[model samples]
Target: MAEIKILGAGPVKRGVTQIAAQFEQGTGHRVNVEFTGAPTVRERVLAGEAVDVAVVPQSAMEEFVAQGRVSADTRVTLGRSRMGLALRKGAAAPDLTTVAAFKQAVAAADAVVVNVASSGNYVVKLLEKQGFSADKAVKQPDTVKVMDHVASSAQNLLGAGQLPEIRELVDKGVAIALAGPLPDELQSITAYDAAVTTASANAAAAAEFAAYLELPAARAAMAATGID
Candidate 1:
């Protein structure tokens, strides 16, 4: 019935794509979702990019609302996920049962690659707390690049990314396997929140979709992507 454009974070590729299709089918709304890095999502919105809705890290919602980039009241949590460990194909999975084992695995790794996003942020803290050298972690701009570096490298490497993104990468043959979710206490969770943009031309439709994100059906669709 209406058309809306959504700017979504890279980690949200799976969840957003899945839900958008269902929303379009159920509502007869033409939904177009563009996936990019989290930083780009913020940059585009802050720079006045025309969009109906956007899904980004919940941590950015306050900033967007404060900047008048998106309607504060339209914000809703779509999905959530925590960091996941990845290792080169056939590499031994780390023993995440204890912090000591995790640290030892890190020390033994020929190289450690991490995306400079939510996943990496949590990993840096975990490494610091365990007294592991953060310098050992090679930071990539995003998860795609992190997986590329790990998969292509001949060295035995360890990488980190969002749980869903890591699994996505594994399917692409980028990372050999997912190593872990880390200790529950040490894992960092990121909430994927969606909001209608202030610049939307189709405010009503955008708001409708934003609200639909909280519906049980939509929430389940998002979770099916392993992001929730």
Candidate 2:
């Protein structure tokens, strides 16, 4: 059996885990998966980690393509995801019907939990595009920290002036107040792509795993994990 390795971000981790399990069962391939933030993934690739395949946002994937780190011909976009917001379940949802309202909500928020290494950059960019003051936006280091602050109702509470992780907040009873779901023109979406590595000892199997990602069933599983 060919052994394979995968590098990915959290949002894609759940979906990739499901897909990888299925692929291994069908092909008898042994697969190893490494999960990290988007920026961390970039750093790992640059560090020349021995991975057979990788899945990441299209823009980051493109960076690899540009650097000749990934096979140009094998690049494929599997799915897309938009930015979103979450609030504590019992908390009243804020007004996001208009761009102005969204801006105001963010500005007036006590805290915002964001995935610093992965989604944070995009969120910051969106805020800047909307003319929101960077100095005023409350920042959290990572998703876990964001959740910890919100879950504990600590000084990092979004309502108290912070932006927490959308998914983590939702899991912790936070509701969607304002976010990057469709119809919100101020949102940014990132395409997820997968490709085989040039250094893989099992190139054929790696390609097979990459191809499996495009299967209807696989795509459905991915969507269930919020792959859009």
Candidate 3:
């Protein structure tokens, strides 16, 4: 079996995991996926970790290409993830139809949980620009843990993360209510891309897997997991 090692961000975890399984079934290849925050994956790849494929935010992929760590021709845009606000299952959903309302909801929360990943970083910057100090906000290392903290928090907490991850947690019976994607004007949509790493041992197989991510079946899997 062709063993392919993949490193990716948390937002793409659910969709990638599903698509990887389909890929394995169809091609008889064994895929080993490692999910982490976007920055961590980028750092590891840049540090020359031995990975066949690297899947990360489009921006990070472009940087890799510029640094000659990933081939530009091999880059494929996988899908986009939108930032979302989540509350505990029994908590009342907040109004997020406009930027002002979103700011208000955030300000009113007793505590807020965010990850240090792409979506969370965007939220933090946006909040700062809006002159709001997320004094009560806590930044976690990744989306899954952020969601977990929100679910278990004794106080009413607002959880901000990528829609795909939040949806996955909800599917797993996590007690949380996803308010929805942030307002259009304030929305941070992160596009993910996949490419064969420069240091890949199995370049041919890695390239094939990167191409497979764009196929209809893989796209469908991504869409099913809120990663369109």
Candidate 4:
């Protein structure tokens, strides 16, 4: 049996974690997963961490391939994730169908919460381009903490994160309202990709697991976790 160590971003956590268990059971391979922000994952890999496989944003994976940290031939596209907004439960959901309405909602919000990751950075830039200052936006370390802050805070808070991360919390009936995905024009869709690491000791096994993630069952698992 081979043991595979996987490093990935927050958006693919739930889906990958769930599928990893299934992969282990089916192939007798032990899967160890480490999930963090997208930027952190890239930093760790680039810093020469001994990861067997990595699931990261497509852009980051491409850079890794170029840097000879990961095998480009082994890269497999995971699904895409869009930014989404969440509010405290029982609060009135805002109209975010249009970018103008989204701007209004942000302007009227008491406070905005975003993580210090890919989705949050994108939202901040988008807000700035729309003439809104994100300086006051509460930044958390991860998406889960962002939801936790919004859930516990008495203040009316608007939380922004990747759809998969926020949707997982919403599915669990967290004390947050699903305000839906960001408008198309304002949305930043990040494509996720997985590839075997060049430093992998179990390169063959890692390649096998990467291929497994592209199977129909794996795609279904990702879809169930809101990764599509």
C-alpha lDDT values of all predictions: 0.83, 0.68, 0.87, 0.89
Quote model 1's TM-score: 0.93
lDDT of 2 by residue, 48-115 (tens): 66788878888888888887778877777777766666555445566666777776777667656555
lDDT of 4 by residue, 194-214 (tens): 999998999999999999999
Quick one: best lDDT, which candidate? 4
lDDT of 3 by residue, 58-132 (tens): 888889998889877888988888888999898889999998898888888886789887677788888888777
For each candidate in turn, the TM-score is 0.93, 0.83, 0.95, 0.96
| Residue 193 error, candidate 1, Å | 0.6
Candidate 1 ranges beyond 4 A from true positions = none
lDDT of 1 by residue, 99-210 (tens): 6777788888876788776667777777777777768778889888888888889888888888888888777766468888877767788888899999999999999989
Using alpha carbons, what is the TM-score of model 2? Answer: 0.83
Clashing pairs in 3: none
Would you give me the overall lDDT of model 1? 0.83
